[model samples]
Target: MSNDNCTSNVSQSIIGVLDVIAPQIAKANGLLFWGVILVGVVVGIGTYAPRYRRHPLIGILFVAATTHFLPIISSVAASVTSTELLIHTILINDGLNSRVYCTQYAHIFLIFVWAGLVMMVAVNASVIVVGDARERRNIGPLKAVTGAVVWTTYLTISTLVDLYREKVATIQFIEQRTVANVTVLGQLFLIMYTKLIFKYYAFYKAKHSFAHGRSPSLVDGYMDQLQQLGDNSDTPTILKQGEYTEYDARLHPPALIVMGEDNAQVDNQPYGNRLKWIPGQGDKVLTLDRVWKLDDMDMLQSPSAQPKYLVFSFTLFKLLRCRFAKYTISSASFTKTQKFFRYTLIKGSGAAGERAFRIVVDELSFLHDYYNSSKPIYYSHHGFVIFNIILSLYTIGYCIYLMVIYIVLMAMGYHHSQIYCSDECLGEIFEADFAGKYSDYVQRPPSPVPCDTHADLIDGSKCTSYTILTWHIATTVFEVQQNQQQHDKCPHNVAATHLSRYCAYLVACYPELLTDNNDEWCKRLYEDAKKEAARVLSTPRGATATYPLIVDLLSTQSTHSVLKDGASLGKQLVDSGMGWEPLARFWSEMILYVAPSENLEAQAEAVARGGELITLIWAMLSHAGIDRK
Candidate 1:
């Protein structure tokens, strides 16, 4: 009895202290929860033969999510506690109207905050709570089990204190939050359901499709009409037929862009101003038909020509894609593009004609679950989707509740304090790389370049993080320089912009996928770039992290850094007068070029976290038997 009394006193003391700072805690929780949503939804799955959750951020964020998010339940519930305190301190002499608004109108925002916790879990559970056995082994389930217990305990404590009715004013709201979390789990289970249903059929289909000459024929009908536009003598003039016009990609490939004489047709389209069709590097091969090297930048300024458009790496190992138009597609869509490229192979060289293309999911968890069948991967819960579907339906009610309340609150003009802490309002606080790191998010304007940067300064000739950083900076500058009116005409601006940032994020945050080099090289170079900024901008070394300050301090002397080369590239791109077309194609190819990795272990790890586009491209290329080895 004495021990129980002692425990009760201790608990009350903690609550007394919590009551003091709980309001501020609620505000912070609201902000962080939204940030997690912004990063997760905006950057869904995307990767390779690179690595699994190698970057510290993946593990760091996962542990942080489990530990930090548990208390959010109590903090959210504490909103009611806050209101009671408000009533006693400020509304003591006020009437029923004031007390009602304090209890009802003010605390309605708590619903949104509760939803935020559920969302945080939804975003993380796929990565943290549930993963392949290998990932589970590494991450361990103890953290998750502990977190769930803490979350429930917090809720239970609140209910116990306020008798379930006044525990933040209602019990159903808590129930709603729980249902929202479970619904997310159910939806995730549904995904796993489909994965379990089909095996590696896509891989086999892709290989057989290529071997049998059933290439990417989807665009054949659409492209034939476009090819006819180039039938006249005008077509020959526009096509750059050099001495060494063509070489089999199996032996040699070009990395330059070519434009037409009459730039009107190509210019109007998304890929018109972009592509690197390496100037005839003396690459020699007999013409299969009307083979023309598209490497001249001069074509953009030139006159009209037809669109016999097909952009692909004409080689065996680099079998990435061949697309028709400007649509960002699904996994199925990416596969279709690769299938189409086989036609180009058949036309380009008979020697390479018999080979098939290959692509895989190329991440660790995916491989373990599907490709890496060395161990028995139990499909123990594969049949759980039925139960999950029912739970998923319950989520609809919570959504309606949030929406209705949002409308009511917005109309009431009750938006203030925590209500104003929206993703947009708190958006700039997130780094541009974080925004770009997850390709799903709409691209925020990238970090302002302090000054012009240089490519020569970074080791971009090889697939290094420095290359990504330099190009990312250049891409950002070029994107910022675009004319607002042209945003729609070049539908690919968003693609290029997002890809550039995504690559930057990969290099800066996730480096193992891009290079076999040790991470120290990337960090050393990154620190060097910062030091260069400090030197050129004349800022203290300690303050280098301050982006705006560094930009303000930028000077002509900063010409030796990545910022200088990037600026040079951006200026060249701007002067080239092509819209985002070239950049779109450039990134399209750049991403694929880096997709082939010798590091299979790293790739498995990448899949375990969240996949990358490069990984998918690598996997697809794998189907074609295009490998680094």
Candidate 2:
């Protein structure tokens, strides 16, 4: 055949083939691209739509910035390859610069770009999926093995595809040389960024949790012990510290009440300035009900005070040991308030083993105000919700548009085309692609570095592997030590106001527990529990049920008597040479002054109960010391 005729026929054939595939390819690419974006939309909505609108906007911006990278390439390719002459017919007949040649090249480049984007996004999504799966499944070694196998399969497939594309397609830039050269560099940078962000978030959460007292789990391991004592115990003696219930409403007449005090402040006014520490302030003393003698003018001048332990008996006393209620009151004619508390005490074995305690707090009158039908004068949280919904809808629409454009570009041969020069190019692309994934990789929180390196490395298998210590681990260790020293009052610097108070309180309360003696005792007890198949509290973050055992002394009649006996045993405990004496002081610091509750009557009751418990613990300690002698 003549060369001209051969070229002409080939040109026609190429044009015919290109025309058939271009439209279908474009459609498929468009669908796939949009599908991913739609997935992102679902993710954004499902994860963040319920949040404020500002969050949605920011999330959309982030996903749009990150996910649209691949689609953008497709858009650029589509625009460049629009000319009709860029079809295969021109390539065969007119040569490389013709419209067909240019179209073919553009189509090839576009394919690689789109493929890179798809793979990267798919991998990232897979990472999130894998994380969620691991979290939900909470699987062990077997699943981990399975996951490893799957990972290996993916890597093998990726490597093989990368190699194949390099050999087959001339546009092997992404999978080969481009990926390899830049992956490690990208991974290193990403890791640093993640570390900083994680640290900042962790610090914020820890501080927040401390400020707004974290909730203590009701079902701690101590629950079973406490319940056992509560169930089998003797009937408790109920006690009243002051007037159990007497209300004289004539003290502050209804007509004399100030309007400001009577009117509830519900205007949604901001409570405190930024610099003011409002949340941690002590409770205000509000006068609720009082009685004034009509004849004695001196009674009005003197302060009519309630008992100090009044609040503790009402609430916290219930959680500690059982209590004994002892009632005795003065017959004085001066002004007085009514208070009540319930106590249950369990008698321990022997004269010295008796234990008693309380968990209640002091009571106070709580005034409940009726909601008035005045027009509301506050900003609604609903407005932010509405804004978020609108923002999410806009994001979804924008994402859909990008998907369609990407699909068209992919159809025109801009992705997965057989084009690129060398093996080096293929290597670069694969590494770059793999490294791109490192951006989303979150490293597990760094564990404490093992001081006993030999023991850690030489397990039952006796394998020796040196573990690398992370900077985070090192920093956390230092911070923990600093916290410890602060608690110890070594520097005597009250630099941390609220934190310092708590640290001092903890130190004063658990001085023994913080020392080597308590550590040794706890270690033995914990180890024994492990060996005995007993349920012991494990200090795992997020899963830690409750703190370790807290001793209660209120229940036992033996405890009550010992407390009664402690009046004598106190001198004996002080006389004993054993170091156990200091514990009495420590115990005093720890168990005293539980947080005041908002219940007035309940608070007074708890305080009374708590006092009974305190008396009981003291007796038990005294008896214990005497027995040791």
Candidate 3:
């Protein structure tokens, strides 16, 4: 009887204490619940706003912080309401027992919050995928959708399980279970959120470092090593002081430097003009102090060995670790975890390694563009073209096949006339130049044949019937003359000259890539031109020569002379009153049409070795939609 009385007294004392504490706990929880809601709304707006979205790290942190807070708030509210019910049973109902209420309200509230979070995740994922696609990034839509769906399903399942546990469990069991589960989940949330925070912090550091004009620590170190390597290398430069490198300079004789000519203009010339000799530029010529050699091309092409630690990879690995190993003791494995933590905190985030990688990539891209723009003369690698071929195989193959068909048709006596100029005088010149041995190369098809005609010219027969090669040379010579006559620079002439010379280079070096007949004709023309040049040089009058003098000597040569074809062609063009501007435009258009579009691999290979004129033409043709597959 005394033991029972002591137990009753102890129980009554516990009830009295609970009665005092329960109301205070409810009041505090009510404040906390409203506080969490207020904080969540503010954080949501702050995170999702456009201004905050730009700083992804801040946005991620806000989301993670809110997520962690919500679970704790729910747990507290459950405890508060349960204690209130117990107090009502003991005090208001006048019962000797206190009953714990099921945490159904808290479970429902959590489910709703998680549902909203799932939707937010889906929306964010969609936005990211669409945004990346709009920017031409290779983000697979299906992969993004799958990832979103899986994450959403997982969250939904967890929420549903919490709700089920509240419904089926006893009040005492539910209270104990909810507290333990919430505690574990909150800890897991913190670990996961902390990992994400660090990952984004790395990204933040990388981007900020770059924006501030400082190389990321990782990139700076790598660059230092690269500079050291370059300094230690024994590679020779292409051009020393006082040496001039001309455009297509390898094929031609060293330029004759005329005395007493103004040389000041040469030094201020642009990059393109630096490779060619100005017609009137005197003894002081354009020279390179230092130039990239063919060996440099190899070095440029070689990939850098710098470590690339992306924030995305870090985040992904952390997430996987949390998902698979969160409950396992192995998640805290000593050596590997310590190493990873040290590496990420020190080597990875120390200087924004990902940003450094991106910087390297961007610099490499700029170097590529520069290399392409300058047009390299030689290539050291044979397989360089393979990359281009693989990228545009069908387009390249179709272009090659079309070229072959056109060549075959031309060889079989089918001819196409020039479309722009329908001048009768030009026709007469073409007829006279190709009249004898080259008659087969220039044949006039019957009436109603396709030909380019001026709007004002009613007669199609007035269009010239010269081969494409003849038109190329005539326009090139005319453009060169016009460029010399004008003091101001003509961009069209510059383009025409470079393209024409590149075409000539192709004919001389890679004849098999062109039509067989045209290749032979170009070879014959080059040989004849060399002989005529030698003959003209032998004459005392030709000792001091200009391009015009050379043209005159070639034009006046007899029909039986080796340069008779070029002579007649040059004379006819000179006699025509049409200025060089129209001719320059004609050659520019003609080269675009005539340049071999086949084998982008070959062109890319050329570009990798240096820049390639063929690659430029190919790119232009693509832009103009002239060579669609």
Candidate 4:
């Protein structure tokens, strides 16, 4: 009886041991195999992290490190760790058989994806910190920090949702699902709130600045003032620190002289506050918000207190001086021509902004009396300089810190082992363990086409056809150009066809145009002179250091007035229907012909609208000019 009982007990013990050890052994083997590979990839990536910014190779290293190592580690962890440990410690799994174990692979992918996202965020934050400090000196550090916090919070929440759903399987688990969903939703809400706050605040600040004739914000104001100072013309001639000079009450009476040296003495008659008055010179009145400087002789000229006002006035003064200088420097042949033009225009003109600019009127008065005798010494000026230096260093340090923290966190969150190399494998791995729908969202599209060849231009004939098509389509107010027989739906213009046709026409019309010596032919086809002149005119007024043509045009008072007014008039004309149409059509055709189809849509629409508007203007002009010729 005892022998039989012993044999039965021994067999049962062996079977029970095998049953318990089999799954555990299988999990252990899987973990060990993946763990080594993950470690190798992570170490390789980390070694090359510092070089990421300099070369594309480093970027590859970083991507591989985060994507591959994280997944491998995650996979190993899921395989090795018990379900209870995963649920309690890692916040993953449900007590739902082997399915829970299989779903745990998502946790591995979650970790790596999160690693990539965090790294990107960190890189962006570092860039912002460094860039803002250098470029936006007036904006306080608080602004940048606030933006970073808002952005980081959003990213963190997004990552958490990804982690919960993919890695932990919390999306399917009732106990953890509610918390996961709430975190995901809360993150989204916070992003929206932050965006709204930033947008409205920016708008308010801009409006406030515009109304006050100051910059919209403190930073903007400072930048504007600095720009003004940099561009101030009068300040440069009179004093070294003309922009910094303090202007006070004791100043000159207006209308001391008109032009040239002031040799004539006027009787001290009572004007405003017992100031002497000159007959031809207009009265000088102080205006608020205008910048002025007290000269060495301690007489006021431009405006006082506000530095930007002074700079702006000085710029205007310089412009006038430049005009006079141009006249003096004119060639003998040109001088007679300019003088004749100026004399005739001046005969009928009213008092100009320049002609009335007479304060003490002499070179000595301008040198001594217009500029401030003493300059301001503000503590703030020094403080600002010091602050800028400190801020620059601090910004650099902070960026480095951000970069390091990001890399470390990314390394911690994701390792190279996490990413799936094959789409088929990924789909199978995820779907086999979880629902098929879980894999759908993670699916990636194929790589895009690589750019290689340069584009060829359309020939004159093709170009002409394209021009005609544009003109024809534009006549319909951008309504989809319909076929004559069937107007039921908007027809696709397929502008590419027109472009091809035009290109063919250009080739046929001037076959030699394709040759290297075809510059003459190209010149005939393209209105190069007009294009160049328009380009010159359209360039921003103050951006260039020198504008010889602008200076020449401004030499005469009437011409100067005309040029200034012309800019405004041109802007108005271009904004109206006549200007908009041609511009729209040209841009549309250029885009449709030159750019990818996806990018051509907006350009085509613009072209069609512009052509239509231009045609209407042309028709109207034709009717007015020739009476329906």
Backbone clash tally for model 2? 116
Relative to the true structure, candidate 2 reaches a TM of 0.22
Candidate 3 Cα outliers beyond 4 Å, as residue runs? 1-489, 492-496, 512-525, 545-552, 556-562, 619-625
Residue 194's lDDT within candidate 1 is 36
Report the poorest 10 consecutive residues by lDDT, candidate 3: 428-437
- Global Cα RMSD, each model: 20.2, 24.0, 33.5, 24.3
User: What tens digits encode model 2's per-residue C-alpha lDDT throughout 1-629?
Assistant: 34555445545544555555456445535544553454454333322231222356656754563455434444533432332122233333333222222123323333333333333333222211111111121111122112322332343344435434534223333335445323432332233233333323332332222111110111111122222333222311110122222332212211110111111121121421111112321111111111111323333443333222222232222212111111111112111111111111223344212212321112111100000100010111244345435544643554465467558646854334422111211122111000011112222243342222100000112111100111111112222333444545332222222222332222223222121234344333323322321121122321332111100111111122212222223223324532322433333333332221112222223232232233333332321221112
lDDT per model, in order? 0.40, 0.27, 0.35, 0.30
lDDT of 3 by residue, 32-124 (tens): 454345344433433233233335775675455445444444454455334322211222222233322212333333333333333333222
- Candidate 3, lDDT over the whole model: 0.35
Score candidate 4 by lDDT. Answer: 0.30
lDDT of 3 at 149: 34
Backbone-clash count (model 3): 5
Candidate 3 is scored at a TM of 0.25
